[model samples]
Target chain A: MERVVTINLNGNAWQLDEAAYDALRAYLGAAEAGLKDNPDRAEILSDLEQAIADKCSVVLGPRKSVVSAGEMQAILKEMGPVTDSEGFAEGAAPKPPVDVEKRLYRLRQGAWFAGVCSGIGAFFKIDPTIVRVIFVIAALITQGAALLVYLVMMFVVPSAETSEEWAAAHGLPFNAQEIIDTAKKRFGEVAENQNRMWKSAQKPPREPKVNAFVSPVQKPAAGYGARMFAGVVASVCALAEAVIGLGVIFVVWSLFTTGAVLGVEAPDAWPLWGVIIGVVVASAFVTWPLRAARRAAFGALGYDAAGSEAAFSFFAFIFTVGGVWYAFQYWPAARDVIEPIWLWFRAIIAPGGF
Target chain B: MNPDEKFAPLRKGLLEFAILKVISGPAVYAADILARLQGTDFATQEGTLYPLLSRLRRDELVDYEWQESQAGPPRKYYRLTEMGRAHLDDLQAYWRGLNQTLDNLGTFGGA
Candidate 1:
């Protein structure tokens, strides 16, 4: 008994022999490859699917429930191969060999950290381990500048997810026959070799997960556009966080140092005490927004932001209120420090020297 | 060389013109267009027609609307645009000019 496979063509369903299903899928794939340059590829594919479905319905009868492999051959032969610009012609000459351009893309399968080094390796046909070693050496020599370059590459370079991209990444022709061969086990051997090499290199005797760093929170397969959009958003969020974090740390550090110096010189200086207290209180208020900003950044990457946001909000509200109360008690001390600064500011703005 | 291989490029070129002529009359579905061309010199597969139709639509030469079909899903009914009509007119004129040139070739039998 021959194996029958059920397939959904357009909106209609049909059962075909296993061989027939493969043939039909390959035919459609070839058509897709042929129309790769066309802007209306999706629409044309949908049209082609519907046409194939219509033809299948005509072939099906009360006696013949399943479409045979021979029938499928006839149908595909009748439909003819899709060529660029020209749709179909009877007994047309064989299609000329089209040039396939190789592209550099991060391979998601054997990625260590965002697949930057591996992608470079694949492009240049070098061992990924060698590329990783070079990157580590470069990063050390440049004082972590190369690590920053890796981060930038992760954002700029696309991850090869589709069959066409995978084929292109390996410098293989993206034809129907090639796609079928490459899509299955072409990269499997390379990925396995990389894993073995990586595991062996580790000094400690421990189980090493192939994608240990990347597997956790691995992003869902998204189109190139969606992936690029997420990368841009994440980069912006990261930049903003760095700026805010640095600014807060700077403010806290200067205030603490100034207060400590003045307080040590004059034990009775209430203004210096106020400066120290203000720094402590201000950090609490600052922490809230930083945490919230972090939560927003995490939330954009499909992570749960509620836990951190709620915890920080509770502590921030309490600290802000306590700081407000402390400010009232140290009103005189704050005024003492403000008076000289206000006078200095006014003197600098005056037309003549005071 | 095979006769089919000889005229393949010529037939492929004429297929689009035939499609434009077919759609210029009425808003025809892809299936209807295929049926009309069946057994003709320019007869083509649905695979070929769809992409060509898409290209025509992209060029603003043809536009399609989804119409409810009696069988299966909604069908795309394609009609010629104003630009397409003008393009067809030019092709027709050029074709007649070529026919005239061919017919009058015997008169200038210098070869």
Candidate 2:
């Protein structure tokens, strides 16, 4: 007999075989590690859970109860990998482009405001100052159509906020330091011109104060700070979603259990079967949702949330039925406890209010 | 666009103007919005549509409500807010003015 462990996922209870549970846990841990620094980490994680639940529910039919290892793997594959691949790290060497994936991004450090022209320059592999000059000339000649287009572009295209994002935008592996170097490369000529002007004054050869304007080391905090801020916002939004989901589940649970409480007809001599029936009724209502939520939680996180919900539901049902059967078979002790509770409920619930 | 890539700005006000125009009518879900955008130049743009919708919502031009669905979990149904309608009106007028300007570009005078 396989060991089935009950787990609460997204506030819903689910049963998983011990092996499946271990694998799912590992996958989720990887997802956390991979998305640890992502700005939309919370949103992506929530969406993932929802996706998993949907897929699992679809996978679990009338007969299937436990999610097998194969099903769990398939679910993750469909949702997309959460773990970062080996050799994919910060500042890794840029992979040689066998096929070009062109993407545009505004340079954060050297931009004269919105970095749109600089992004355009990077895309065309031209000097950004030349691109800025062209835009100025275009604005002058094209009756501000250039300005309107620029504004439109600012709203339409998203800015690349991180080296990983920059890489993804260009369909390349993330090489954070390389992209930073490229951004600095664009400003090299302008900086050199400024240096020449400074040197022509024939003053002492001072420290290369270019470090004051454009330091390669200063890039980390700005990139990370923005990501942290976005992550916080995402976490807040996710907390709100969780609160709402929990609230709904709580209401559903209470409604079922309380309704079952009213099912006892005779308060004075409470039949053990009546209490058992109430338990069975409550359990059915509780079990399906728990099963569904489990499937989703797993499926969303890369494990399809199905199969196991069935196994758990079956066990919960069997236990309830067996419990009621035992209580009815030996009704004397149960009646003592159930009798007072029945009396209180019957007294509280008014005549016609169900 | 590359030779193999057919993704157009489809009708290219980047679909924001058209999106608000559609939402200005009935409130709809993501699937409904996709359906409305279907057969237009913006068809097959699942990637672009979500970000555009997100930006529209972030700008407070649109809002969403969670509506329970019989088949799956509740879905977020999107609708235009009062601000969205006003923005749409401004955009429409600006579009008209741009069109008139383009028409008069035959004259050899610069603005």
| Highest-TM-score candidate | 1
lDDT of 1 by residue, A69-184 (tens): 66886787777776657434443454543435667788756777668788888888899999999999998897666766777566556677554566567664323444354324
Provide the TM-score of chain B versus the true chain B for each model in turn.
0.90, 0.76
Residue-level lDDT tens digits of model 2 in A1-354: 345555544434445554445444444444444555555444444445555566567777788766654565566555444422121222222133233356766554366755677677767778889988998899889755576566545323444544344443444322223433443443343235442211222222222212122222112223333433432332333333333343344344434455333243334455545645555566556545544554443222221223223323433343444444445456976555445445557778854435
* DockQ versus reference, model 1: 0.31
Q: Pick the candidate with the highest lDDT.
A: 1
In every candidate, how many clashes are there? 1, 11
Compute the lDDT of residue B8 as modeled in candidate 2: 38
Q: DockQ for every model, please.
A: 0.31, 0.02
